[model samples]
Target chain A: MDMGPHATFIWTAYGLSATVVSALILRAMLDERRQRRALARLEAQGIRRRSDVAQERRG
Target chain B: MLSFATLANPSFFMRLTDRVLPWLAGVWILLLAAGLYMSFFVAPADYQQGETVRIMFIHVPFAWLAMFCYMIIAVSSIGSLIWRHPLADVSAKAAAPIGAAFTLLALVTGSLWGKPMWGAYWVWDARLTSVLVLFFLYLGLIALWESIEDPSRAGRAAAILAIVGVVNIPIIKFSVDWWNTLHQPASVMRAGGPTIHPTILWPLLVMAVAFSLMFLWLHLKAMRAEILRRRVETMMMTRVSSAVALKAAE
Candidate 1:
């Protein structure tokens, strides 16, 4: 697209926005994966939440 | 109907988000695609600013989201402090980095837009300066959360800071009117409504909605991660306590 004399500024703004937003999405996805993995590992070792343990005992 | 109590439950929140996220993602993607097409192809170049006005398509949304995200944090902080809502601090904590990212984008994009139009890359104007303060507030909240070891303590401390820092929001909004600034006064949002032509306004609105959806999607995912992290912390503490009890029994 012909962005006149200041095309550089226009493209750079869009590029930077895309970069920052993509980074945020990547970080959120990675952090969620890490937490889920840690929770699963702890559960595998029979370490469960107190609420879960209490529910199990009652059942 | 889901009650406030049910919505506040972490497990319920997690499950609900899991079901809602996929749909939200779909809508967000479609709207973003449409917004970009409209911005680049449909919106005409300004007679005065020329094509540089294209930058506003993204810049304005980023600027709006920056304030919007901070407002979310502040409201969540209030919930954390007063009602002691279980999910409130998680909401605030998850929102900090996202809010910071948006604020940084707003500043950088504004600078980029300013250089060609305003003849400088940086300005100490009221609107710009207040926004800078908002960015620092986001950073302070993030640091406060990270510095403390205990989650509850960290949440309380961060909540206080978030609440106190919220005064900056109104200041940022009214800065142009309150003080002479290179930045233009409110156009899209004002007493008479948007001054921009319809061609530019439509794409801007579409992009704003798309950006908001994107924020909501990310915030939900971050909150889920936080809930899991808390669960892990509780389980680890229980294990340690059980081991100590066994050692004492010996």
Candidate 2:
């Protein structure tokens, strides 16, 4: 679509916003993955979440 | 009390968010796609502003969300200080950078829109200055959190700063009306009903919802990551303590 004279301003706003939001989502996803791995490593060493321990006690 | 109890349970939260996250992601995508379509193709150009008016779709929402995100930080700060909710600080910490990013966008977009209309990119006026201050406030809170080594202590300090910085929110909102400024006064939200035509208003409102949902999705993801980071820290601490005990015995 033709955005006329102010197309630059309009497109820039949309482009920059998309970039910022995508970067944040990517960072959050990576961090979540990293943390999950850390938790898994601990679990491998016999450390588990409190809920898991309580479940074991009940079982 | 009941809700707080449920929210405080980490495993429960992880499970709950896990289920809801996909829904949030889906809705955000659907809404954003619709909003963008209406924004560019559906909405007509303004008689005065022309296609530049199209910028309002995202700009207004960013400005609105900037304030809205800060409000979230303030409320989470209250939770941190008063109820001492386990995840309160986590929520507050997760929201800071997101709020800062939105605020920065608001300022930049405001400037871009302004330059085309006002003949200047920025001016030291009430609305503009207050938002700039809001950006600084976000930076200050993030810095406060990082500088403190202990998580609990850092959370408390950042909570206080978040609480104190809330005074800026109102000033930013009312600056256009309260003081003479280059920034245009509120068009959609005002004493009377919205002044803009329905053609533009609908897309702007839809865009607002889309942005808010986007923020919610991001905030939840950030909070999840933070919880994991803390878990990792705790695990590291436990390992260090165990190693020290074994060495001491030797």
Candidate 3:
């Protein structure tokens, strides 16, 4: 679509927004992955949260 | 029915978000697609501004979401401080970077639009300066959270700053009218109604809703990550303490 004389301005605005938003999504996903991995590693080493320990004790 | 207390529990909140996020993501994507199509194809070029008016679809929504995100942080901060709600601080902390991103987008897009329309890339306008201030406030909150090691202490400090910084919101909103800024006054939201034509207004409104859903989806994801990070911290601490105890016993 021809955006007339100011096409650069319009396209740049959309491009920058898309870049920033994608970065946010990537950061969130990476952070979630990192935290989940750390938690899993700890659990595998037999380090459990207090609540989990309490539940096991009740059984 | 889940009560506020149940929702406030981190485990319950995580479970609930896990179920809800997929649906929210779907809706956001669909709405965004529809909005983009309408913005590009359906909406007519402005009689005066021509194709440049197209920028308003995303720019206005970004600007609105920037303010809306800050409002979320401010309310969450209040909950963190007064009620000490478990998820409140997490919500506020997760929202900071997302809000900052939106604010930056607004400033960047606004400047882009300004360059073509006003013949200058940057201006010391009241509205612009206030928004810049808002962006700095977001940065300040993020820094405050990072400076304090303890989560509760960091949350409290950031909460106080968030509360104090909220006064800038109204100033940003009314800056156009409050001062003789080069930026135009409120067109879409005003006393009577939106001044823009229906063709433009529809796409703008659609994009606004889509943007809001996008923010919600991102905020939820960020909050879940934050909760997981805290869980990891606790587990690590537990491991260290148990190791110390076992060594002492031996």
Summarize candidate 3's per-residue lDDT along B1-250 as a digit string, tens digits. Answer: 8788888999999999999999999999999999999999999999988899988999899899999999999999999999999799999999999999999999999999999899998999999999999999999999989988988999999999999999999999999998999999999989999899999999999999999998999999999999999989889999999999999999
Candidate 3 CA-lDDT value: 0.94
Rank candidates, DockQ, best first. 3, 1, 2
Candidate 3 TM-score to native: 0.98
C-alpha positional error of residue B121 in candidate 3 after TM-score superposition, expressed in Å? 1.1
lDDT of 2 at B197: 96
Model 2 lDDT tens row, B96-195: 9999999898888888888787888898999999999999999999998989999889999999988999999889888898899888889988888999
Docking class of 1: high
Q: For every candidate structure, what is the RMSD over all alpha carbons to the true structure, in angstroms?
A: 1.0, 1.7, 1.0
Question: Model 2, A1-59: lDDT tens per residue?
Answer: 89888888888888888899888889888989999998899879976555566799999
* Per-prediction backbone clash count: 0, 0, 0
Q: Which candidate, 1 or 3, would have the higher lDDT against the true structure?
A: 3
- Report how large a share of the reference interface contacts model 1 reproduces: 0.93
Instruction: Give every collision pair in model 3.
Output: none
Stretches of candidate 3 exceeding 4 Å from the true structure: none
- Per-residue lDDT of model 3, residues A4-58, tens digit only: 9999999999999999999998998899999999999999998899987898899
**lDDT of every predicted structure (CA atoms):** 0.94, 0.88, 0.94
**Least accurate stretch of 10 residues (summed lDDT) in model 3 chain A?**
A47-56
